[model samples]
Target: MGTAMTNPAVAALIARSHRLGADPRTTNYAGGNTSAKGAGTDPVTGEPVELLWVKGSGGDLGTLTENGLAVLRLDRLRALPGVYPGVEREDEMVAAFDYCLHGRGGAAPSIDTAMHGLVDVPHVDHLHPDAGIAIATAADGPALTEEIFGDRVLWVDWRRPGFQLGLDIAAVQRANPQAIGVILGGHGITAWGATSDECEANSQEIIGIAARYIADKGKEAPFGPRIIKNLDKTVRRTKAADLFPIIRGLASTDRPQVGHFTDDDVVLDFVGSERLKELAALGTSCPDHFLRTKVKPLVLDTAPDAPLDEVTTRLKELHEAYRADYRAYYDRHATPDSPAIRGADPAIVLVPGIGMFSFGANKQTARVAGEFYVNAINVMRGAEAISRYAPIDEAEKFRIEYWSLEEAKLQRMPKPKPLSTRVAFVTGGGSGIGRAIALRLAAEGACVVVADRDAATAETVAREIGGTDAAISVTADVTDAAAVEAAVNEAVLAFGGVDLIVNNAGLSISKPLLETTEQDWDLQHDVMAKGSFLVAKAAARILIAQGMGGDIVYISSKNSLFAGPDNVAYGAAKADQAHQVRLLAAELGAFGVRVNGINPDGVVRGSGIFAGGWGAQRAAVYGVPEERLGEFYAQRTLLKREVLPEHVANAVFVLTAGDLSHTTGLHIPVDAGVAAAFLR
Candidate 1:
């Protein structure tokens, strides 16, 4: 089900690849045909001329064709880039490009043909649209793009798409062999010469870059201690669920897709609108995201204890205001020929006590909204990381929001890539929980890098999965910074890159709070909290360097939330780990990385991390059982099953995959729903 594109799909893909390009969001008129021509004899047919695809006129790319394509010999076009620099005017380069297209008998070649030709890729297409211009016009656009793509992408200054642009791109490509695409400031992007599928993949990757930039720019500047207050759990869950459908609609394009849902009062209350707009005004993650999430968040001030009747009435009022703002926005910017706004819709909805709600037509769209909300929270968190986040100018926000080219770019997108080549690094990988996650990601075809403190343990598990297409194992002490860094480096070296990191190596210690010595705290922190952060930081830097984004998993415990006797150090450290993941999620998200935590309850197996004497103390304190520990733990859970390491690993796998791209900055409890029934 998760296989790469097949031959038929590949042929049809290349022949009809022109359908893959999106126009620059700023360009109001003109489309360009752009693609790569292979020069060396084709390995498949030994023919030289190979026109991958053309950005055809008169149709949405979603339904493109090979008939629309015009193949060209690569050798002829390759000579053009070298000659362009000697030419004096744009006309000369345009004429040269046209000559190549006419010689091949295709539609006039893309205006960017010279640039595309010089790159020597397998597929390519180019577009001119408005959304791109909106971003190009931003002050921070170039810096933001660089942050997202790292050194793998090239940025070209805004120039007409003939000789000048081609020359600029050629020089950059010559210098950076790993560069993938070129972003033209105040213009559209150019992703050339890959499979038609790869062309589309490049576009999505660009979108991700833009999304992260916008998210980073818009977050609030943080200040002071975070004062947390408890609230009614039932109301928060109900509201988050009620809002989930709309949130799905507003962000992700499909419903009942991508990810499953869970809501928590603690999470919601922490994010609710006591000062949400004051926060959102800080700006969006970046300007481009405004095309979907808008520039500002709608806020609700209702208290958690408010009556349902009052909250419902207030929500409707907020919804109406949002609709009114939409009409005003469209009216102010709509061109005479543009479509009219006839519906009452809210891009974002806020319900007091339930955090924020987003609306979408389907699950995919809702996921986008969820991503926006998550980023908004991150902005708030990051503001604390740096200075307070401040809102961008309204004109700048409008530039992105109202750009038809940008809106059109969102018209069609490539299907979500199956999580085929992703990799996950799980510490303590040989047996127990780490083994479970290693197996899960391996099953998904992700190279599973299993590292453990024990060399043989890691090797044994690595050997077991050696039969898989992507799986590896290594030995290291998670607490040892050098070892953790080496493990991450080895994974990156072995696998091209790492997309998922699960910090699951930890031990538990239980004793009376008074009996817990400073050494106990330091030891627990070293292996658990400090190790998780070290591993996460190492992987974070690598993912940041890749500029492709990644996922990080921290294996914490339920004790982080519910306190008893003994686990003072372990519980505190686990709690710190959870909080650290949240901070890391905010900081690294701009690079497309998502950080999350998994809190498992009573997952006793192999090495007994949870079998500390503190359990006896808790049992004595709560007057439960020492022998029925599993049942005693399960009694509080709705599912009434002793939590297992496998359960936590499975959750990590899902979150690390394509299924939960919209989720980050929160903790998912794999404790059979005990946390769900906590207040009850």
Candidate 2:
């Protein structure tokens, strides 16, 4: 990227694509494709040949790089129409593209390849801008296109993307030499140019014209006033948190899913509108929208102010009906060759006066699906303003949804990590073993909630894991019951619900039997024992409500078993925590929540407890130098090697990541063989 790119034509193409993609009005993420055709020397023949570089399948235009481009011989690609067996068998052309490749062909070509190669222009940009789609999906789209652009921009009826659609667009372009672009009915927009600059400009111009036309000609109050005005922000968020776990449970009936929640005013407006039910039932207008969001959302039927009991009951009934409807839809269109129905659960759910919730295999996919639906909402608003909103036929949607090529893409996804679709909530995650545990869980593909008293450090660790979609930070003093409950609510609000709860917050104070004060005893027990109980108790509600089964882990210490001098309070507190593992495991088994504990001795390198004066106190007690205490502790162990945070993190992974799914109420020692503290 930084001086790595060599080809000027490809460079211009990428730059233009980024410009178009950077604006949300231009395209949604991973929705559009761009291409550049230029001269390249044939390797064996050493003759100048025409080469086409197009955005590869499943790649986003804004983030696209040269490696994301599929290069093919223009002559061979343009020749495909001759051999094309028409629309029914146009899918076979995707396989034939490999033969047209120049060298290895940077990335796999998408079905839209023909749309780029067959065009006579040097550059082509196909986008799904909201305003353009509004015009494309309007009932009077063809007539509106004729009236607004006056023939410079033409119209094409709804056609599923394939080699046939590509040929069709090319035919329209050739028929009207004066036309700059064409509005794809019920899809998006495609603009071509003599050069890369012209192509990008034309794409922007088309989008601008459509936007201006909609704004000037659009009718007011198209959604027919707000049916339920937004609830107060604080109240709305609380309601969202309450509903999220329930919705997540219903959504995951088919497969375990991660969820995302949004309460932006734009989303609030749409959900609260009088037309919400009618428009949502018609489904999203754009192909990309429904592809991620499913054909339509499961909209809550009651007013947002409905009592919680009433709303939850209604939601469950709606979910059941929705799944039944979805299965019937699948049965209606599926043939022998159709890709198997992935899931009957709705990906998007709408609650009036509250917010929208979306679900997917991971956080980013769920979040993006929400964003695409927001785009669809905007499209619907504009279309209804100018004319009635009209999407493609449902049969056509089923064709694209169950297409074998789409299935191949699904099959091509790399195997998920062991912890994929799991969300972990780690207290004391800003530092020490908790930080290490959070990092490990994220690396293994779990969304993380890094909760700590230190706001800055918690956010830093969360940022390290990756931003909003992967991990989020919540600041809370674990000892406070209210704070613990609120933090769990934050996790529910952020990632729908928690799958793993790690009670790792603690502080150590060393004192002999007679010198230990009541304050020290209460502080240690309150933090390590009661704090763990509060966190587990609060998160267990969401886990139980989700009905998805989860894990609760305690980072207890080897001192819980070993009698250590000058550590009466800390040791007793950890011992209390250790027993809680078995107790909770027994009580929670019926709910499918596994409880486990990891006991590690003297994890000195990155120990928050050791760093906070415990090292020097223990050193003084053992008659060793403060700096040498770690070595002293290691020498006394059977393995004679110091245990570390990473070692404890590995133990956490093993206990929860499927291998030990059947093992619970277990305390696995990670003390490098401390015989005295070994589990019996």
Candidate 3:
């Protein structure tokens, strides 16, 4: 086939990487692999998937699949690299590869096994692309890289392909414990980690750092050295110093790269050069360099005697023009299906004899620009013999520049509707609290599967919301572990993922401790406690396997904290549920699952529980008019308002949404004054 496989998860991952500010071209073409075991062949048999994952032969990594990847055995492939005759003989090599896999009894792996095997960490990555090769293959690459990375990186010149490269990397990593990633000259970079997502993150971070270094540290063009000597008129040096940090910040906050070039002569001369106009006309920097520097730089070559208004006007004009050009470039290339690229960015500036300017959104982007400019200079100098290096097409550039899904990912702040598309399964979804939570989650756009012991009630609730088709209502007693598993499986099969789960299905009783029988305790615990565990366990597997983060919300009661007289069985069982939330949060956090409990006090407004307690008994407890109990609870301090199911629903929505993205492992009070009273 001419193209490679693409799947939603891979697309999402690529989107995430892009949002982190990685070049789509750099990260898009290559495939990625991840597994559960940190460092084993397989978690089950201890056999490795060699490469663990390989990009399909011709697939676009922008859209790849778990199945599209070729999982090979690394040890076997490393051994075979030397024995193999040529690419044409790969068929024969496949036989030997099968033999190695057969040793582990039908466990097949990737051909890049040896490459991945070399990484000491659990995750490994390898890619070959022109952007990476452009920098790696340069003669002064290592020295230039060393100037930027210093002792933080491991830089290796080109080596023989296959096993030798892997071996060299392993040797370097073993020799240098501080190296988190490797830059293979003329090939690509490799990042490792304790987990797959971490490994992917490490890869993005290293590339970003490298890109930034290039933008920040590379040389400008040759000219007069130092701004003071080039300026025709002198200004207060103290004022210049004062402007330094602010200028730096303004320059670097929005570009791919900005660096303070130390080669004073190069900076000043280039700023004053006659070719500045021509270069600016063509575009600021190259397309790849756009991330390093916005397409062009601001030029200031007028005499130091120029008016302050003149200087201001020049800077403004240059910035505005560059923004216009960027928009034009975007408009010319982007398609109807593609998203717009934000182009009001100024990446470079030239202050005539004063010096050159560069900027990135951060220090790293500045560094990336430095490296890019150095390469640009080299490319220009080399063009004296051949053609100036032409960049990839505008369409390709737009594809990288305007990728939408990637843009949606870079939120360092809290957001709402984080779990909007997430699927949640709630027990007891028919009436009372369970139905409230399910409807609330659905209002937040979660595809909710409501499971209840009563079939008719479940169906009725599912239908009332006009979600008959989309909202699944499964009739299964929470106490039946098998039924819970089946329902969870059905949800996964339908949704492809599960992100939020509300364990609100429960049975309550108010018998005194001595009066509670063995059957009553067993039945209550089985439904309220064990049932939650079963559903959580099944959903956790689906989430952890997918590597997509998930959240679990347990519906508990205030009685779980306050041991009231004559409610021993219900209190104890609910307490167990709360405890389970804590333990599950601890265990599942590593797998990216967040668990929390919602404890409600006297929230049984219209439920059967209210029917059992509403008469004189409720009146005695409140000591108020029977009809005024709502106002009594509402005015019992704090906000002084009766709690609505909607209020509890609102709490659930916030916890599951972007508002409380960082919270986990605790009980939140949906009960107004009761929880606060105990605390006080």
Candidate 4:
């Protein structure tokens, strides 16, 4: 038979890791690691030698590939236990691992590499499966595991991941030679076998054992009625949609944190239970969750129906108290031997009847935390059903949360994009200039809301962008006050709050002064003037409540500054809207909301107004073919370059990204240097 070092063996191992990691029930995002022992030719010397290909730190196993695995000399890694006579320092041990790399590329191997190496097997799978965690965190976890798996499994106490953890696992393996797996109390599970298939099978078998055990215990009855009563009361008195903005604003930092509000029936039921405080105070279900969610979630005192200003004040006070409590936890846990750890505040916030909110540096991180918490709720519920939920004690949580090894993993993470955690609202986002802006903002890592008058078109744009976690579609008529209000509320519900608002919904009209009807004038002003006001007013309320200073940009036109012949109604409305931008900026400057405008001339292509027959009529009046109309405007500018929709979007990005943070109430011409439209 071919040895485990064969190419097929390695390929099978990689495939198994991807499959296990892809399921959140098996592994949370980037939370698990896998390894396989094999022999391969050294890239430098071309000599056949034993090696360990392990999942690298910070690589998501769900989408892991060959490059995501780091290759290290097996003999060198196994020798690590002998090289250090006593407990090894984290930094020195990491340096030694770095020295043993067989190749120069790929990320550093997972911090748990030594643990995987100590196992006496060809294949190893380490996972934080929800079912396994549910069983492992129970008060009688070890007893339950023994009852379910007999001699097949061993239990290891919680130890910070490093040299010590490997030593503990090795000790367990020494006593139980027949053991196929080991459960790390308050941590996760590890399974090993001689082949990739065996390793995967062992994991599934162990998980099934625990899952059935929990299922047979039956459900906890008290949790349901209490939760339903609280949730119903909260919903009756207060709307989650109304308080989301306030919570988002108070939770934000200078880096612009985002909130993901989820009231999924399961989550609401969990948060509404009478034992929420007790369950939350029990600590995280697993050690891996500590890094992403902190020690425990912050439970807010405000309810859904509370007054807006009153709730905002309460949140600020609660957040300050939460920070103080974290500092206290750090001080009590720090010792002469403790690693230098930064104070990490709560990443999840519980809002009673409203459900829970997860905060992160970016949308993906927030969503990842949200997923972990949801799993945690299930695990806690299961543990409560069978017995008391007993997670690692506070000191153990501190050791893992502040472990130098875990801190090193964070240092290796990539830097985020400029607009990483900000949220943007784009009106008329289904197409044209609005569509371009939405795409650009999303690319910069901001969660975007595509708001348009057409519901289907907005949904198409949102699908093209992605889902609710990344983007959502809201149908809104900017000219209608109630619709505009609903749009802002929807955005808040979808992404917690709004950081940027792009007012780009407008129509155009061209006619001689004598031929211009009152109806035509009203139509132009209603969309250009009234629409901009309604959208801005709705967004400003949330921004001011948040106290985080936001951005608003109106897509104006050159007709505002330089009126052309036979365009009375269009020019008048555009000019009025531009002046309104200045007044709004002056008033909102106190609240840190900057209002700006961009004026683009003759953007014929990809424009809804131009495509709706206006371009052809305008071209005929100018005695130019419709195809050449873009060039006609291009030649009129000093730079003589066509002003594409992208150009206007770029300017919008500049204003919203704080490039011109100090300058507001200004209109920058994106018309390739239209001299007549120059502000100066």
Candidate 5:
């Protein structure tokens, strides 16, 4: 990467790719591939040779780095056609591409490598822009190309992407010397230039012209007349919130799946349109869209204004039907060597008045799948207005979806983390022990909900964990039952449902029996005791409904056992939390929901409790400086070590994940060794 970036042509290609990818008009996320050919020094022969640098398989042009591009000798690539076994054996060519390496080659060459390499151009851009696809999927796309850009933008008939399609494109380029680009039938666009700038300009011109053509000449209602009016924004979102968990559960029948819901104006319009079922059944045209969105979306026939109970019943029936149809679709096209049926669950589900719900192994995949469908919608709109919206047939789609090359790519991906499919909800995650727990769980590959009463700090912690895919922040007062219920709902909507719950939200009121007012006891009890119970009760509904086993961990204190001075109210509340763990464990054991607790001595550093004046109060009682309390506490422990929040976080992880699956109703002490606080 370091040496390659120094080459001027390689640099120009990367810069151009970034610009094109950044705009949705040019390409969807990771939708297209771009390439440039340049001179490279042969290490052994000390001779200058032409090299091809193309965006490799599974890379996004917008965020491409030098390493993301594959390097190959142009001479070897151009020579492959001499021994071509034809389109039937084109998949083998992807393997042959390795032999044309300029050096160690870089990332693996994409399926589109031949298009860039065999086409006699210095720079090339192959894209799947919505506007370009709009025309490509049109029945008269070739005529439209002639009508709009004349011969300057040539047209290539539909051909599945392979060495043959590459050769087809190469032929088009060679024949039309004045043509800047070719509109690929039932796919997207490919443009080449004498230089990087010219190629980019050519691409933008084609997309802009197609977009304007559709805007001016296209019909107003491309999807046909609207059949159902949309519900109000609040009702729409509420419906989505209600259905998300149930849909997630149904979607996870084969394997656990995270989901994303989108009800934007575009999606709403499409779902409520008369052609919703027809267009969705036709599926997506572009390889990028089809690969992400599956063969076709599952379209719900229920009206938008149906009752929730009726909708749920009908949805279940529709879901089973979709799965059966998908299974049959696979059987119709599968061969002895075809990749094993991955799953029958539809990736994208379209519901009128509600929205689209897309599922995948993770949130990012689900979100991207949803976005690809939106692009497909735009393509459908334009194609319908100008000509018939024709996508590749089912047989062609099956060939691409189960392509052996794609299966190999999946096999090469690294194994997922232990908690990759799980989601964690951490209370009081804005600061202290909860924050540490949230960060730790996320690191282990769990999507996290950082819930705190303070919205700002919760947001800050969520940002630290990563983007919306990995974490989201929710503000709720746990003592209020409704707030606790709403907070759990947020987790369900953001992720699929809660797989783990860490009841760590609490503050302390330290005072001796004489000075402790009734208010002190009630406040501590309300937060630590009642809050934990409310959170557990609310989350249990989701976990049980998911029908997947889950975990609930309570963060108790050593004071729950030890009779520490000036800590009666705090100790009693901690004791209450500790017992709830056992109680829930016994009650929920039959459901496969493990309940556990971690009892830790005061973790002063990063402690939200300590920062809220508890540190000064405790220090005064113990005759030490507030900052020195940690050192004093460390000296008093049997291990002579101060307890840290991370220690408790580790204990929580151990109890919930991996080897400890069967163990439940257990309490692990994270106090470094405080004999007085130890369980008898």
Candidate 6:
């Protein structure tokens, strides 16, 4: 270890923490904390004092910055245990930590601050490693640790994290002065050393020891093959797509946001195991997981070739039962003095014969929950391979779940955006109205599927919004049924399910009835009329299956209602689309799928139709220069302002964002107050 000064010591600690947190095997998404004690001059007194710079609550160590570390006066933190009473010590400890802030600009200290302060060494690292937790949760964890490392490690019994836990660590250290680390039963491992490098090295060494031990034990006693004789053939991704939204609807408090589901190889393997029910009944291996995954997962039965409607009905029943069981669990554990907490709904769901599903307020949280559950599955398998898996008792779980300190971390999080967790599919999303709508939706936190006939443009637009999680690009001709189906599958694969569909793909043709050839008529009608039908049909299947409400917005034109000269084919096709939206609204209303249309006029800039020489042709018909055509149209409107693509996009947002939740089967004119195009 280098002979670094006090400031360098904290820097070294931060760097090392980032390295470990970046690896999922070491720590999954803000689940771990690290601290380093160093000498610093007090801002108020200008006197030298010891300070503990610990990872703050709700901060992700993987991407930690200096501001993410909470600095507290070590002397005050260390003195708290001596003065604290036995009752409500956790709350008292948090209050003390708040009072001891060294300079005050950083986030609140982590709940484990006292434990970090109590360690005698200069540097300390705490992490819930998958391998370490696997060993820690095994019934024979202490015995196994002793056999593996002899006296180099000390074992601590299960205790909820807070003031008492800090005292226990100090006691263990006193007994095992020469120990390099402590193995926390039913929790995690902690290591400390004189230098940051040494501390991290020790942490990794302990994890490596646990990993090898688990591997060897698994080889010695391999689990039997996971055989489910009557298990349905794995559900197809397309069919499984519909199941999550229904789950979201049931799980939500008021309005349902989208739910993201995953069924990777690991998830499928775990769910397919014959012992799935038994293993899942066992609690989560680590306490931190309880924040996201809860004590147990909801398991649903499935069958081969099950119809979507049947699966939806079954899920609704299971969800109701799950909520009842959660309420009962809370009632059993709640004390008269205890504050009422939210129901203990399962964060992760296991659908036998299909795979696992995780729910969150948004896509990011859902994905995080999925990641933690996957890690839990691996840890449980490893622990059982060595010995019977054992996790913290139910009482301990309740304490951690309801811990005021832990709940505060979530409460501190920023409010979600209006469309957070909603997924939208926008056809012709590469440019003009489609692109604007896609970007706008993404800005409001919706995961957008940018579907366009132009592959390159679709990809560019998707990248512009944000990669993968925010938007995904799919190339498909909406008029082609197979292509439309494929595009829908792409959206489901990327974002679980679709909550909004924007039918915005179209072209303009300025030809009189006599001049309009069959080819021209078919091209306009196929894209405007047939294309809308195909996309709507494909999306309707999913929306109906989801059973949660959804929105379908059609991008028609004012010409559809008030036909312009020499625009017969374009007008007729758009009219057909508008009529189709009304018919669809009539049929799909019972399923909570709202269908509506927006009739926009004179949105010439950036329009693909205008770029195809239609602008010049229309200008010639009106006896004006092509550049002045937009001005001419603007003057025609009562408002005398240009109707832009962004205006149309905003209108789309209003309709899809539940602003028009009570209104459907109607047309909204977005034409800058044009009397001719106004709806009567």
Best by lDDT: 2
TM-score of 2: 0.98
C-alpha RMSD of candidate 5: 1.8
Q: Which candidate should be chosen as best, given TM-score against the real structure?
A: 2
Ranking by lDDT: 2, 5, 6, 4, 1, 3
* lDDT of model 6, residue 601: 85
Model 4: lDDT to the true structure:
0.81
Clashes of 4: 1
Candidate 4, run of 10 with poorest lDDT:
228-237
TM-scores of the models, in the given order?
A: 0.39, 0.98, 0.40, 0.93, 0.96, 0.94
Q: What TM-score number comes out for model 1?
A: 0.39
Candidate 1 per-residue C-alpha lDDT over 283-400 given as tens digits, one digit per residue, 9 for 90 to 100: 4534424544565656655665666557556655665676677677667766675544424454455444555555443323434554545544543443333333333555555544
lDDT of 2 by residue, 1-680 (tens): 12225778989988987887788999999989999998888878989889889999989988998889999999999888889997878899999999999986378999899899888889999999999999999999999999999989999998888888999999999999998999999999999999898888899999999999889989987888987978898889898988899899999999999999988887888899989999999998677888899999999978777887898899999999999999999999999878788999999999989999999999999999899989989999999999999898788889888889989998999999999999999999999999999999999999999999999999999999998999999999989999988999999988889999999999998889899999999999999999999998998889888989999999999989999899999999999999999999999999999999999998888988889998888999999999899899999999899988999999999998999889889998999899999778
Scored by lDDT, model 6 comes in at 0.82
Worst 10 residues of 6 by lDDT: 227-236
Query: Which ranges of candidate 5 are over 4 A from the true structure?
Result: none
> lDDT of each structure?
0.59, 0.91, 0.57, 0.81, 0.91, 0.82
lDDT of 4 at 299: 82
CA error at residue 522 for candidate 5, angstroms: 2.0
- Kindly list the per-residue Cα lDDT of model 3 for residues 425-508, writing each as its tens digit: 878888877788878777666667888888888888778655433477888777777887667755643333456888887766
What residue runs in model 2 are displaced by over 4 Å at the alpha carbon? 1-4
